[model samples]
Target: MQKRSVILAYILWLFLGQLGIHRFYTGRTGSGIIQLILGAAGWATTGILIGWFPLFVLWIWLVIDIFLIPGMCRNPE
Candidate 1:
């Protein structure tokens, strides 16, 4: 398996993490798609308070991913 870079992953996470672009770059397509959908839908439904939950969760997840990303790189598929 090809090894991913921690630095690139951090950069992606810093910039595009909100839309799950960092997950995609890290070879987590499933997570990326889920985040993408949630982010898009969250923006679309912003008029209601319910939409903020997913975005909030995603933000927390992304922040946690800062530590998790190195592990992901260590065990790539």
Candidate 2:
């Protein structure tokens, strides 16, 4: 596998995280899919009252995820 830049990954995660493109770029397909689903859920459910909390959690999760990508990509399989 080719080496991926952590900085680029972080930028993508911070900006287009909801699309899971960052995750895919980092070779984390499972997580990318999960993020995509959760993000979609958050987006679709927003403004429905009950969805507010989940959306907040998802946003926070995305932020944390951005920080974690470097460590995850550095790990040896």
Best model per lDDT: 1
On residues 1-77, what C-alpha lDDT tens digit does candidate 1 reach at each position?
Answer: 78889998888888888888878877888988998998888888879888899888887888899898898777765
Worst 10 residues of 1 by lDDT: 68-77
Error of 2 at 77 (Å): 6.8
Tens digit per residue, CA lDDT, model 2, 1-77: 66788888888887888878788888888877877887788788776866677667777878798668877667512
Instruction: Give me the displacement of residue 46 in model 2, in angstroms.
Output: 1.1
Q: Mark the regions of model 1 whose C-alpha exceeds 4 Å error after superposition.
A: none
Clashing residue pairs in all predictions, respectively, total 0, 0
Candidate whose TM-score is highest:
1
**lDDT of candidate model 2 versus the reference:** 0.77
Worst lDDT 10-window in candidate 2? 68-77
How do the predictions measure up, each by TM-score?
Answer: 0.87, 0.77
